[model samples]
Target: MTNRIERLNELDSYGVLNHKQDEELNDLAKIASLALNVPIAQITFVHDEFTFVKANIDVVSTESIPGRVKRRESFCHHSIKNPKETMIVNDASKDSRFINNPFVNSDPHIRFYAGKPLTTPAGNPLGTICVIDNKPRNLSLGEKQLLDILSKKIMAYLNNKRKLLNQENKIIDDALRLQNLTDRLPVGIFQLDKSNQNNLRFKFLNKTMKEMCPSVNTNKSSESIEILFSSIYPDDKNRFINHLNESFDNLSFSNIQFRIKKGNNCAWFAMKGNVERRTDGSKTFYASIRNIDNQIEYEKTLEQIAFDISHVLRRPVSSLSGLVNLVDTKEKLNKKELLEYIGLVKTVSTEMESYTRKLNDIYQKKKEIITNHNKSYT
Candidate 1:
């Protein structure tokens, strides 16, 4: 009636099918049974093919009511057809619409029925709270009003359940979306808990963390700093630990570069993070680690080149200047003296050639490293 697909979608957004019954809904059904003085009272949700009994109370016999049944067997189906008002049948045996109904003709043998539709906030009927009796009788105006009021109470309970569930689902969805975004990044995002100063642990680790540290256990709350230092080069281990300790004590930001060794291969990583303090005096460190092996190697090579230009190249150039000055002072140079100067110049030129070759090799290695790293990403 309410555009079947749209109605079902709205129902699904509430997420209330097949879940365990709440005590509040059960108590409402009990109250309905007592107030109406009926042997059977139920809170039902009518779907396309079935009627889901959210709550039920039967006092006539020891027989238990089912959680669900075919819509054809449920009077709640007829109740929802008129979403605006209640549906009452004083004598089901005489009503042509339900005279041949299986529920009336055989089991349960309902002769009196009163059902109030449970409508949604948008005025779409979800189901009903109906009372059934075995004997034919008329309902007083007060009785009908009481049933209507109870139906509204049931709807209120359902609406609250839906709101709480929606909030929980939103939280889970947001967390998953954040994780997906971080997974695409090349850097390793992490949060560290140093509250227990003696036992450091990682509260969170993105995908890149596992890829970067294959041997480290990500699931356990092991000593993260200890594991980290063990994987780092021996020469850098102490400085790295000290830097971390200093940051924790001062609640300051840290930016440090260090080398990590996995198996025999080593790579450089640059870590940058800031400490976040809590009202309870605890702290968390959020950080990102980026692979910087190529950058560091390039810088080291450039430093070496600078040293060569300043010290190594200067030695030979200075020797050549001295030789040129001697030639300028002499009016005529003898063959033997010219030969000695020529030999000295040859030795200096060879040294300069060696320095140029070293510079070329460093540049070539840096180019290869960059090209390979880029290709790996593609």
Candidate 2:
């Protein structure tokens, strides 16, 4: 009895018994009952103590009636033990094993039984396809063969359904992963779908995109691209349009810095994106917008500082250099007199000019560094 329990658990682990009800199994049950001319036909997973009905024909109970017989008293328990062989009881009342069985002696008496075991793809018996009758009857060889064929069909249907369910679960998992990644991305991402020759709609926008341009959520009826262009400064509109058109034509990435007006205030944004040609002769544009106003201002300030150093300090440095040459080349009347003159001129020109040139070089190098940093924005 313990061995029977272990075997039943093993069969249950195959998951065939866990399947959902479908039209295919119902159709098979109907056909089997009609062909066998039986009042009841069932696709059942037989366990140690009970049978689980997967599909049934003309059975009042959708599930098996509990305790119709004990585990040791069931013929299904004996049949599943030799899964490769079918079990047929032509006369249960005459069979010694079933003559005194509770099911045969009392209500819902059973006298005829035929069962073919249903096996998994790996050839383990999971359950049975069975037909039952109240009176003793025998099945012809042809009928037995037909039952075997239907059992095989049931196995094939179960396998196909398992595969489809697994595939759907995988698809759902992948979609969830992608959605999480998109939402947590650092950059502000947006998608524009071309609705027509002149209209583009916002198909999607991530959280960061909405925060960067609050007005982007406005003008719900207007197309996304049109609204974006309308926000651009009038002076930069042509250049922005030209760059966008060029990017589409070449099917390449584009980077453009333009000023956009939000209400009465204006700021600069660096827009970068790619144009993708879809299969339906339409286009999709994906882009990220970064606010670059502060960076641009910092770069301009550095440039101005460099210009001031070069122009304001060059003349003084040159004049000091000439004065230093004069002092170095002139013959000295006396050591003391020459030293005094040199000290006076050096203090007035040479030292001052040298310090100015050094300051100028420092400012110029700072400007170069700033420019290099700003270039990485796009």
Candidate 3:
């Protein structure tokens, strides 16, 4: 049990104690009032100096009743002292504890009283389900039992309502966080529901997607995916579709490079996605689109450079090998002539080794550059 003053102050802090109305609470009060045949049944909260009715079944003129009344002056306050239990006073005037109370003896008297305390999740009492009457009357055991059951129902309703509110708030918070992340991403992100008649639609599109395809409005429902694919290069469109189908059918990640016509220019794009099959024999995919035109062009240029180096080195290497073979196979000659031929063979061998080293270095560097670029795009 909490100190009466402390409990009253805690009730005030709930904010629902005063000027808050709920239709559900009012319905509960009405049911309790009818079951007990009481003119006044209320969900009340006790503040520092007063008991405020949060929900009432009947019209009551008075408000802010004194909370710190003496034991002999307040039946409602005494009833809520033990929050864990219900207090049923069949006749307040007949009860020895509240018979001499000033409120009962004077005007706006309380004769019949019954109250069940309301507590929070932490077991702190906030208010009560109370019934009062101007005339003294005894209630049956059945009526008391019904009032107790109604109080428990009211508590359950409040608990469930609070849980629902918390869940709703969490959902809203998660949505905002997801939106923030999507907006900041540099690549185009989208989801496709392949379940709908082999048609791919964008379930999500990031800010980058809007910027990349300014003419493709995602907000419209009639935007056909086929129309989008039609913009792709004729030679690459079938291959791109084939790759996408294979990935989805095999439940593997798909990586595709294709060219699309953007205005008068042709641009290349790299797409990566994962396929997911639902329980209902339907599939979906999530993908990221990236502009890889510059990367592809750079790769082509590197390949051409490697080819040119190989072409230039091929003639020199062949000539050097022929000269070495001829020098080794020739008949005996003068000492000076033989010595000069040997020196010429050594010079050609050295030149061939240098060209080979340069070729290997270029090949290794090109591989490294391509690997790094692929990693970045992925």
Candidate 4:
């Protein structure tokens, strides 16, 4: 809804009403004072509940303290009400509006008042830059135009303040969003300065990076790198470091798979990285690390199953084929030969059944282990 509080936020962004900055607007106040031939000048902001004075030139204050007045006591209240036009009370004693006003009857003893509203681009009036006099006097048309020009200058200064404030806030907002996004990512991400092998250090690291390598310290680059490598499984540590060193020396892409100790257990991981070379001949590496424990387990299981089929069942199947050929060649067989053939057939069938059962038993055991391991991750 259209309301005074709605405009308060945008007006507060200029930072004028928070405190008195008499020096900031004193020059403008001086111009208004000298041009209008008045002893008093001020830049004030009129809100719904109070009138806040940004700057004052003379001893007269809207309140007992400087820079504040209740809405009921502020003459600038009328100025904001009629934003499109200037309010001029040439003789406050004669004007019905100010005849009983506190500023006119009591302190500051208002006699003449002239104010131009500081209007926003959206046509909302924030307050006024005004000149006041203790003695009565009217303004010429040229003098009125002069007051209008001074008001424009005041508005221009406040508008510039608002723009800069908004820009600074926008920059802070963008930075926060980027930080949160990197933190929530699943894979660990890091940036390293590869300018010198001896000076290799992490320049940037995401939240996941710390989670992966618990001892990592971004501030101590060499020590953090050493800590991370120490967690690698003994068998794969050398291969991973060799690839990384080669990539750093040639400024080339690197990819490697390794395992790291996770307590008494180990987990598999793959790392991929590429280098960016600056025009100054300095190199940097952008890297990512991903967990590959499940994938590694699956591939190993498949290889075991293939080995069982190739090696375990091969001898039994060959023996069955030879037995069939031998029986066909013995057309006129004796009783002993017939019995021998039957016994051999019985032995072969038993061997085949036993081997098949062994393969099934091994597969079921592997499947159970995989299922339980996967549950822990979930």
TM-score per prediction, in order, is 0.82, 0.59, 0.58, 0.70
After the best TM-score superposition of candidate 1, give how far the Cα of residue 276 lies from its true spot, in angstroms: 2.6
> Ranking under lDDT, best-scoring first?
1, 4, 2, 3
Ten-residue segment with the worst summed lDDT in candidate 4? 215-224
- Candidate 1 scores a C-alpha RMSD against the true structure in Å of 3.9
Report the C-alpha lDDT of model 4 over 28-125, residue by residue, as the tens digit.
98888887888788888987689988877775545432578887778898878888888998898898878888788876888999988988887778
Top candidate (TM-score): 1
What is the per-residue lDDT of model 3 for residues 209-238, given as tens digits with 9 covering 90 to 100? Answer: 665565556565345556457767778989
TM-score of 4: 0.70
Cα lDDT for residue 41, model 3?
82
Give Cα distance to truth, residue 1, candidate 2, Å. 12
Segments of candidate 2 deviating more than 4 angstroms? 1-21, 44-54, 59-82, 87-113, 133-136, 180-184, 189-191, 195-254, 258-269, 288-298, 301-305, 311-378
User: What local distance difference test score does each model get?
Assistant: 0.82, 0.73, 0.73, 0.81
Off by over 4 Å in 3: 1-27, 39-115, 131-144, 160-189, 194-199, 205-254, 259-268, 274-282, 288-302, 342-378
| Index of the highest-lDDT prediction | 1
The C-alpha RMSD in Å for every predicted model, in order, reads: 3.9, 7.4, 7.6, 5.2
Among residues 3 or more apart in sequence or in different chains, the pairs in candidate 4 whose N, CA or C atoms overlap within 3 Å are none
